[model samples]
Structures are given as structure tokens and as C-alpha cells.
Target: MDGQREREGRAPRRWRHGPPRWNRWGDEEPRPRWPWPSTVLVTAFVLFGSNLAAHAQETERAGLDPFARALLFMTGAALLWRQRYPVPVVFGTALTTLVYLGAGYPYGPVFVAVAVACFSAVVAGHRGAAWAATGTLWAGHALVAHWLYRWLPPPGGPAASWGQELVIATWAVAIVALSELARARRERWARERAERADAARRRADEERLRIARELHDVLAHSVSVINVQAGVGLALLDTDPEQARAALSTIKDQSKEALGEVRQVLDTLRTPGDAPRAPAPGLDRLPELVEQAASAGLTVEVEGKPPHLSPGTGLAAFRIVQEALTNVVRHSGSRHARVRLGRDGDTPRLRVDDDGPATGAEAGGGGNGLAGMRERAAALGGTIEAGPRPDGGFRVLAALPLDAKPATHVKEDDR
Candidate 1:
């Protein structure tokens, strides 16, 4: 289910900030309840305000008949559905306003409904519909006021002046312009919110992969050592009691170290922003890895000096070496492995090889070890190559850049 949501471009419910809020842009936000209070208030204002406007312009224009008052009320009431059905509401309001004007009812707050409807339509991403409705209303009004006024009510009323038409045109243009500006801002804000969610998800996925790699390295190496020591203890229990005691002791230490590392990784999940309780293991702990490998019955020969490395690179290098040796002990028939550490200019080069005719015990079961190593290297702008050597042995080679910083957020793929 979570995978489905991810594939469908939705974050998991657990990661959501809260229930979705209202969005005019159709972003899966819940539909708001009909705007009762605001719509009712506006409708009341338009109805009463039209009466006031009619009283003021009484001598020069037609009086407000029952039909004129009904048109005003209907235009305002149409606002109730503006957000839900913006295009229809806008067109409906525009039509009612045009009819009221054509009947020669004195102009008043009747245009308020048209303005609100247009605003809602544009913000709802129906820009074309909003613009069309506003344009149609204005053109209709111009025709009635100029060319058709001779046959309409208020006998002998003069044709509307060009100045009046200009004012109305300017008002319509201002309404559309303001609505368009609001639409642009709404879209920009939505885009920004989506970007923030994507970044957060990327960071989360990177952290999860990091923890997975850490746990794999720690458990694979330690458990392999423990398994070997347990076997040795069982085999020598009667023949060499003292040797068996030493093997049991190694098992205890390896298990304890594995538990500590696992706990450290878990701690990050629990108290995410807190610093680690212990410093991460690095190349300086090479001797410890050698000792652990020896306990697992693998003779590890280390040549050349360990290169200086940043904490992250050092930890990665240490794990690469650790995983390589674990693979040898678990899969290779050869009891001996060689680790060569050196530098290629500013980059560090690490190679681990075991003489083998192929024991092929499914190295680390399902072969995540090598893939994990490659991911770690790739994250730091480095490379990993692991395969059968030309001379019939298994080899793992790593080249890591010195200037590469710690991967605070690793990409799944370089993009």
C-alpha cells in the first residue's frame, strides 16, 4: 500500500504533516463547506445596496421592480457555489448581472457577485473561463448601454457616456488582473510546498539507506566471527578445554560489539537529531578488524600505511575492508586474505584479495555486501569493483576521492 502511494506520487500517511487543508488549485485538499456566512452577508449587502443605488439614480434610471430585486438577490446567492463550481458560478453571475442592467435597473453593488465569482474561478485554475465570463459580461453591457438603450426602459434616457464605459472597462480589467495575480501566487506557493515535501522524502530515504548499510556491515562481520568462534569452541570442547574457553570468549566480545553498533544505529531513529553516543569506527580501527578476522579463522595480512581520511571516508573505508574480509571468511576456501592500502595521488585505493578456486558459498547470502559497498562509494563520488581476479582469486577494489565530503544526503542515482 505504501509502495502504491509512492508510485502514485503521494507521501506515506505517516510522513504527512496533517490532514490536507483547503486548496483552490485541486491538490487533494478536502472541499470546503459552502461559504454560508460570507455569502449571506454579501448577498444582503448587494440586495440592500442596490435599493440605495436605485433611490439615488431614481429620476435618471428605471425604478427597481420586483424582478430587478430578484436579479440582484440571485446574482449574490450564486456565490454560495463559487468555490465548488467556479466556472458555472462566474458565468451565472455574469448572466444575471447583464440581464439586470439590460432591464435598466440602476447599477449598484450587483457587480460584487461577478467580481467574487471571477476571483474564485481564476484562483481555482479556471483562468480561461473566468476571463471569458468577465469579457462576455462587459461586452453585453456595452451593447445594451450604447446601441440598444433607445428601446429599453427609462424613456428618453441618454446613451451611457464613453467616460462611463471607460470606467467600467477599467474596473473589469482591474478585477481580472487582480484575479490573475492571485492565481500566479497560488500556483507558486503550491510548487514550493511540493518541492519541500520532495526534499524531505529524499532526506528520509537517504537516512534509511545509511542505517541499512551500517547495520549490514556491523552484523555480517560480527556474526561471521561469532559463528566461526562457536564452531571452534564446539570442535575443541573435549580436545583442548583452554582453547575452547578462548573461543567462547571471542564469541562474547564479537556479540557485544555487534549489539553496541546495532544499538547506535537504532538510537538515530529514536532521537533523530542527537549526536551519536560513541565515535564511529574508522581506518584507525584496522587492528581491531584484523583481530576480529583472525578470530573468524582468516589470516589477514595488512601492507602499507593506512591513509589519512575524514571521519566519513574513514568509516566507509573501514566497513569496506570489514565486509571484504567477512566475505572471504564466509565464502572463500582460502584461509588467508591480503589487504593493501595506498594512495593514487589525492585518492585512496584499497584492495582485498583471497586466493581461491571458488568455494562460492553465496557470499553474505543474496550478495548485498558488494552492492552496499558500491552504494557507499558512489555516494562519496568514489567507485567500487569486485569480481574474480584474473589469476583465479576473488578481489574487491575501492577508489575513494580525498576531496569528497561526507554524504549527508545520498542520491539513489546521480542526477
Candidate 2:
């Protein structure tokens, strides 16, 4: 019901298309449109004493008082605000009916007031009041309505209608059951919508993280290489124009490659299915990295070959080695480095060591370089430990799952 939307704070008045449709008898209807029951139900009740007089001349039914009819009509009119004041309406109608019955009014369809009131209570989320109304209606039907008819003798001395009493009681309790079922259905629907909203948020976070990793990997590698080539070009520019020209050419190549990788990452976001993926960089490129370091003034040694891994894992391994070498060139003031590849216990491990002092950059605690590496390793269910070695240098060791399903956005404490 749209009223439930209002209760949930959505301000459902905006969705109201027209005046309350009388046929809003179903759960799918927005406002729980109840039949007014104003003119018809009370008028029917008021005519009961006259009808009984016509049927049995000797029967002494209570003559209808103007005040009793006044109260009855008032009870029906008050039901118009049931949606806004459900509990109050139910209690108000029930109290007014009690007064009317006590004032010696003939029994008619007055029980319809309680039935409609109880149904309204349940729809408006007043379960406690609905149950209270159910008990009140049952008691009034069993005691008051029964005695009102059997007060004086009729011609045949017939008892009050037991079958009619049962029918009225059954209708009151049936309305309570119907209201409970509607409440349960609306609760279940609300829960499903919440779950869908949470899932959408998780997907958005994952996409943002993947793009961040791509940018960090591509930009860090290219910028480090360009830094070295620019330094080489400046050093050789005075007397050796030939080598300076070569270094400039290498810088141009690095810029083109970085720009191309950046473009591919952006395209993947815009046209994911249609964009052609470049071969993911992996440990196979380590030799080229070593040669590039050799061009710079650094000595490097490789220990073993890379193991087979998934694409995400392979890219993580490549970036770890790339970041390690970049730190060696930029922070470790040493010329010699060692890279070892092997299995550590049950997982694939990568170890990059260098005979250099533990500078702030190489110590692996501050800035995006170390945080990005940790993020990558943890994304594929892995860990990285980097610190100064006891032998007076920095050592970075990372271990990863042999085969891991790519996970969503990762956190440092994910493991």
C-alpha cells in the first residue's frame, strides 16, 4: 500500500493519482480504500426495530431513541479518518457502539462498525489495537446483541438467532487474519529491496578499486622509466649528441606506451565487452626489466623462473617486481639487487632484496607505493612483508594464492 510507503518516510502523497477508490479492497491498492459504510450500515441498523415490529406484533423490541441513532450515524462518520488515526478510530467506534447498545437500541448490523475498524487498524500497523478490537467485538456479539433480542417475549417465544451471531463473530476474526497476511507480505518485499540496494553498492566499490589499481600500475612504471631516461639525456647532452638522441627516443617510447595503457583502461570502463584487451603484463617481462636496469647504473640478478598463475595474479606479481626495482633505482643508494622466485610453503612467493640502506621509500610503510602493493597482494588473498634486513639492507617478500578467484574491492585487514 502507498500508505506503507508514507510510514517508511518516502512521502507517498506524491503518488496519489485520484480520490480514494472505493474498490481499494485488495492488498495491491495504495491507500487501503475502505467502503464508507456511513449511510448504508447505520441506516440498516436504525430500521431494525421497525422491521422486527412488523414481523411479530407481540414482540417488544426496544423503540429506537433519536440519541441512539445519532450515536450510530456519528460512529460511521468518524471512520473516515481511520487511516490517519487507526488505533483511536477502532477504540472510538467500539466505545460509541457500546453506549448505543446499553441505551436499549435494537440489534442491527451495528457489528459492521467494529469489523471495518479492526481491519483498518491492522492495515495501518496497529496490531495490538486490532487484537483488542477483535476481543471487544466478540464479547459484544456474544453478550449484548444476544440479550437485546431475547429481552421480552414474542408470540411464538422463539430464541435469538444463534446462526446469525456466529456469522458476525466469524467476520470480525476473519478481518484480523486478512490484515496479518498483508503485513507479512509487505515486510518481505521491503527486505528484498534492501538486499538489492546493498549489492549495487558493492559492485560500484569493486569497479572503483579496479580502475585505481590500473592507473597506479601503469603510471608508476612509466614515470619511473622516464625519470631515468631524462637523467641520462641531460648527462650526455654536452659532448655526446648521439647517446642524448637515443635517450630522447627511449623517453618518447615510454610516454607513448603509458598513454596507450591509460587509454585502454578508460575504454574498458566505457565499452567493456567491445574493447580488445592488451596482453596483461606478467613475470615474462622480468628480463626486459633487468635489461632496462642495466641501461641505468644498477646491477641485477635473477634466481628462478616464474610459476603459472591467473591473469589477476600474474599482473600483481609483475607490478610487485616493477615497484621493487623502481625503489632500488630511486631510494636504495645501491647498485646491486637480487630477485628470487620460488614457492613458500603452500603459496607462490616473490622475494626482492638489495644491498642498500633502509631509506624511507624502501622501508615500505608510507605513501601509495607500499599501500598499492599491499592492496594488490591482499586482493588475490596474499600478504607482503617489507622491512630492513638484519644484514643491513631492505628485503620485500610477497606470497600469493596459486589459484584464486578474483575478489571484489579489497581492504588491508581482509585476510
Candidate 3:
């Protein structure tokens, strides 16, 4: 029984995920009900019911206790497992058909049971077994017709036998063709389902990456601010208590702000699948951002006239500036940083420069922060260049469109 189920597609009788263990059923995913298997069982039941009724009537009329009725019941019951052991069930049913016909019982569509099994076998990808069963049944039919010939009136000549063969051949061909068509449809459905799963997985991975980048940007900038303030507070604790107190206060405010921003990013997971959320940071917050950096002891000069910008471009610009300034504080050890934001034709350009070492962490030369800024710019179909300037300073220059393409020519050193 296990072997039979194995050949068919009974999903291990447990742990059904996709198709059966062997994939013989082409059912990687299990349906609530096995439709094809149910079909074979239903066909078997109908054949059994009809043949049993005819066999009973024949027994009453001819006074012969034929065993074909019980055999038909057994054959039909065996067909319930046709999906599990299609080839075997088909052979068994066909052989039983011959026995039932040889027993001098009335012929009442008993071969229909075998036909259903043959259909199951062919559909299950056992073409060899199905054709063998078909040939055997055809020969059995010829034998039965010959056996009954002497017991009944002759219909006609060789034309009658030829007509019988033609009918049998046509029915057999139809069954095979129908099974093949159904198999084709099943394969197509499986392919479509697989493609959809792959697409869904890819989308999930992209979302995870987006969220990861957001977390890194928010936490990295905020934590760096708190770190600088803490260091200053520690340095001024004894000599300048008032200055140290102010630094501690800055730390508290920046920590709270960082917490809020982190919470916002995390909350995105709870948002409805297609709900409208808050817009990203834009140039409107640029003044506040510059003020905060000023409070942190970075003498920053901001000069830019941003055009009307979309949420995406605004967010990209804001993060680039934030990360650049944070890098200014951490890597350059420079007291002064310059920020320039303006429009040159269609492209909105931003440059952050600070007097810092040409090599090392201060210049944003090698770190996740710089790489993330580049990704942010790239996502907006823009380019950014970050490197050491000729005057012993670190500079980050990024130019992205506010919304539409820049009407004027622009030079971009993306690498």
C-alpha cells in the first residue's frame, strides 16, 4: 500500500506541503481535496453500481450464480487507490474484466472500470502502462465478442468486427488525449505558482534591505551626535560646569529624537499593506538639521535654494547631508563644515566640505555610512562623489533631480 501511494501522489499520508514526496502527482502544493483521485473513485463507484445491478438481473433470468458482481465491487474499490498505484490498479482491473467476461455473465460496461484506471495511469505519467492496458483490453474485448458470438444472433460480416475495432480504438485514443491535456494544464498551473512564489520572495528581500538601510541611517547619525556631546560634557565637567551641563542636555535631546526616528522606521512593519504613510524628510527640515549640528560644535555654513522637490528626492538629499555632517564630526575632527545646496538647471546639487585628513574614517573614505549615502543617491537616479579635496579636506558632492530631469548638461563623477 505504501509503495502504491508512493507511485501515485499520496502526500506521505501526512505532512502535506506541495505534491507527494516523489512529485509523481505534479502536486507540489496539496489541495484540500485530491480532485483527480476523487474522480477515479467516483468513476469506479458508478461502474460498480451499474454492473452490479445488471449482473443481479442476469442471475435472476438465467439462474446462474455468477461471481462477477462481487468481483466488480472489488475492482471498483481497488480503483480508489488508482492514483497511488495507477499502473497496477489498471492491470488488476483489466484482468478482472477478462475473468468477469469469461464467466458467462452479462457484459454491462465492466471494462469502464478498467478504462478509468487506464486514464489515471496515463495522467499520472505512466504512458507505457496505460498503452499496455489498452492493448490488453482490446484483445480481451475481441475474445469476449467471439465467445458470445455462438450464444447470440450474428450481426453481419467482417464490416461489423471492423466497426467494433474502430469504436474501441477511438474511445481509447480519446481517453489518452484527454488525460494528456489535463496533465499539460496541471504542469502549467505548477509553473505559474512557482513563478509567483519566486517573485514574492524577491519583493520581501527588497523590503528587508530598505528597512535595514533606514535603521542604519537613523541610528548612525543620531548616535554619533550623542557620542560627540558626551565627549564634550566629559571634558568640561570640572573646568566649565555650565558648558558640561549644556552638553549633557544636548545628549538627552538627541537620544530622544533618535528614539522617535527609530520607532517610526520600525512602525512601518505594522502599517497596512497598502496604507498611505507619512512623507519622507525634505528640505523644509534643513534649517533644523543645520541648527542641531551647530549646537554640536560644528561651525556649519548652509547656502542653497532648493526647488520644489518630491518626497523621495528630498529624503535622499536630507540623508546625504545628515551623513556627511556626521562624518564631518566623527572623522575629520574639524570645527568647521560647509554645506552648499542649490540648483544648476534641472539638477539639485549638494556639497559638504570640511577641513579633515585625506585618509582615515574622518573623510568618509571607507565605511558603511558612505556606501549607504551612495545607495540613497543611486536610488533617486542621481550620482554622488566623496573624496579628499586638494586643500587637505574631505568633500561630498551629490547632484540629484528635484523631480524631472535637468534641462542643462551636468558633470557627474559617480565613482
Q: Who wins the TM-score comparison?
A: 1
Which residue segments of model 3 deviate by more than 4 Å? 1-67, 94-108, 122-160, 274-278, 342-347, 358-367, 389-392, 399-415
Candidates' RMSD to native? 5.6, 8.4, 7.7
Clashing pairs in 2: none
Candidate 3 per-residue C-alpha lDDT over 1-415 given as tens digits, one digit per residue, 9 for 90 to 100: 8788888977456554444443533435333344456655655664656556565765422222446557767667767678777889888988887666555555566667777788888877788898888788777767656655455322321212668767877887787778778877876877788788788887787678667878877777777778778889999999999999999998899889888877777777886484435667777888877877887788988886755778778877888898888888777757799889787787889999999763234322334777777777776678878988998888999988666332322334322
Q: List the residue pairs that clash in candidate 3.
A: 18-28, 18-29, 19-27, 19-28, 304-341, 331-362, 346-406
Q: Show where candidate 1 strays beyond 4 Å.
A: 1-27, 362-364, 405-415
Instruction: Please provide, for model 2 over 1-415, each residue's C-alpha lDDT reduced to its tens digit, 9 standing for 90 to 100.
Output: 8889888988756545555533222224356555456535544654564346434532434555577667777677667777767898898888887766555555555666666777778866789998997778567656754665355323223444788668767776787898888877866776576678678877778778767877876777677777777888999999798998988887888788789989877777876466446777789888977876665566889998798887778888988888787777767778789999999766889999998874444222333666678878887878888877898878889998977755443444210
> Sorted by TM-score, highest first, which candidate order results?
1, 3, 2
Local distance difference test, candidate 3: 0.72
Candidate 1 positional error at 159, Å: 2.4
Global CA lDDT computed for model 1: 0.88
- Residue 31, candidate 3: how far off, in angstroms? 9.3
**Comparing 1 and 3 on lDDT, the stronger one:** 1
lDDT of 2: 0.72
